[model samples]
Target: MSDSFPLQKLQNITTPFYYYDMELLERTLKTVSEEAQKHGFVVHYAIKSNANPRVLEMIRSFGLGVDCVSGFEVQRALDAGFKASGIVFAGVGKADWEIELGLDNDIACFNVESVPELEIINDLAAQRGKTANVAIRINPNVNAKTHHYITTGLKENKFGINQWDLEKVTDALNKMKNIKLEGIHFHIGSQITDLSSFQDLCVRVNEIHEWFVSQHLAPRVINVGGGLGIDYEDPDQNPIPDFEGYFKVFKEGLNLRGDQEVHFELGRSITGQAGSLITKVLYIKEGVKTKFAIVDGGMTELIRPALYQAYHKIENLSSAAPEEKYDVVGPICESSDSFGKAVSLPRTSRGDLVAVRSAGAYGEVMASQYNLRNIPASAYSDQL
Candidate 1:
């Protein structure tokens, strides 16, 4: 976060684009790896969050595994140099062909979400004459208390196999000789800031582990899926998440068997705050009761503001005199393509750089060419 970098760089580059702080990203990765190593837990970066090749390579330098939600993500992870033994393929509706791809690649594990998905993998493994290792993704009905769209552990969400179906799921696994139930996985949700939610998740995991033990199936692994959140309000203040508290929640709450391995699938907390959507203000339209600081970047560049109504702590980087209230908006044709309403800034002016912070996760990866708008090109700080 050099004082001169953003403002000076903004003057030379196009108005709207993604600007990455590689130094920040490297620091974040170091912090995560160090914390995760303390508990002897295996961390798999969720590639679905942000698959930028540069970001992937930087993260891969940390020697972390990858957690993939799609066949493309699996392929991307491998293409990014992640080993086959380090990829965990997880998705609710994995196609049969994708199962074959995993089997062909011999990925580390498949986080099967349903009995049918497990059966499909079993059937596929039999064709390939291989034993497929899997962990049943259980919806423990735990609430992450985050945004509704990101909340996945709820009963109604089409994320994991519910408790009521566990018996049938376990029975299906037992009947299938080729699919080995290596462990049980739980992913509550994403962008979860509350540490208490993780504690609750661990408690639930312990109870589920106990239940599995009662059924003569104590798994040697307990994967508490990652949703630890980074600070959007104050990114620099909280560069790293409370990894000590997050991992410790599982330590105090989960009942682990001897020689058991633990795992996590953290995504946002690792990269979200390290990047920003830099867009120059095109027009500062003043209204009777409100002001709109229109910028070139719209929902096309970063959809979190429109899709999730999410906050990113926008800042007028080029202004330093005083702050004023204005609605930071985008150039998209849709009325919904807005970043912030009544947002206060440093009394912004046209051509001033407006940075939408904490955008590394779903920013560039989710960019679109809607309304025939050119998808914003990206520029990393190191590249500059």
Candidate 2:
């Protein structure tokens, strides 16, 4: 059912729901695994993207590890059947309990962001009488030419350790007894479409690796965190991202050490195009200059549009009469509750089925109950 909506089945279910194409998801997983394995690079699925139960289970079945940002996500990954050794926890602000939780589970590595956080993890691990494996999350200060808010590698962003403090960090690691520095992690940003950004990251990483090697610090793993972007404008044309090309960028650019392992933390590229938000048009209001196709699903169900002013190609699946322009909006009382301004679709009417495509990532996971509205349910193609 490539790009074809199951309208009859959708009509029987509730409106404003997420529809996942299991076939597409599996295809994406298989492609990523195969391509990443070509270079023997390890891939850790970033759970912050979707976190749907079935989705997580499917991803786990593919044998990909997980990258988590929060303590709950680490638990969720564990509950989803991911091994503790396969899970890598990384976040800027990790509480004491969170660090303790990771230590309790004996997680693979904690991508520590700051010197203070490093000390905390070391203390927690000491309390547990265990050595906490850690990877210093370094901010390479690379520019991922995506949205400014999503860009995280710059010096201004509060995500990773600053560049000039490598000496201090290594000094602390040498003094700490409960923390074992095993890796160096770098995550430039998210939703990055340009492969050149990754290439640039590879160059910076090589330089950074040299600094560590000069200090006789041989980091076993070099984790270049995921930020691969998907084609939001045309999901059908490219259902799966070009994993081969994406991997080749690193294979050709990165100067891999003989004893080092490369790892990635991909989220959006794997899950973005495999699902969509299916909402029924509630009203068609005529305006002075243009018309509006109001849908039951709003920013609460999928906040990317409202939060990032993002683009999701809207389709009037039930309409075949003619094409028309519309300002697709939601029922929310807020002014920024719009999905798209001046969107063109088939001549729509009330009760028409409208789909917001390329919503598999950062869509449902970030959903909120802002107006006391019930959270939207999900339906899968395999189940249907």
Cα lDDT computed for each candidate against the true fold: 0.87, 0.92
- Please state the error at residue 255 of candidate 2 in Å: 1.3
The 10 consecutive residues of candidate 1 with the worst lDDT sum are 1-10
Winner by lDDT: 2
The alpha-carbon RMSD values of the candidates against the true structure, listed in the order shown, are 1.4, 1.0
Prediction-by-prediction clash tally:
0, 0
Alpha-carbon RMSD, candidate 1? 1.4
Candidate 1: residue pairs that collide: none
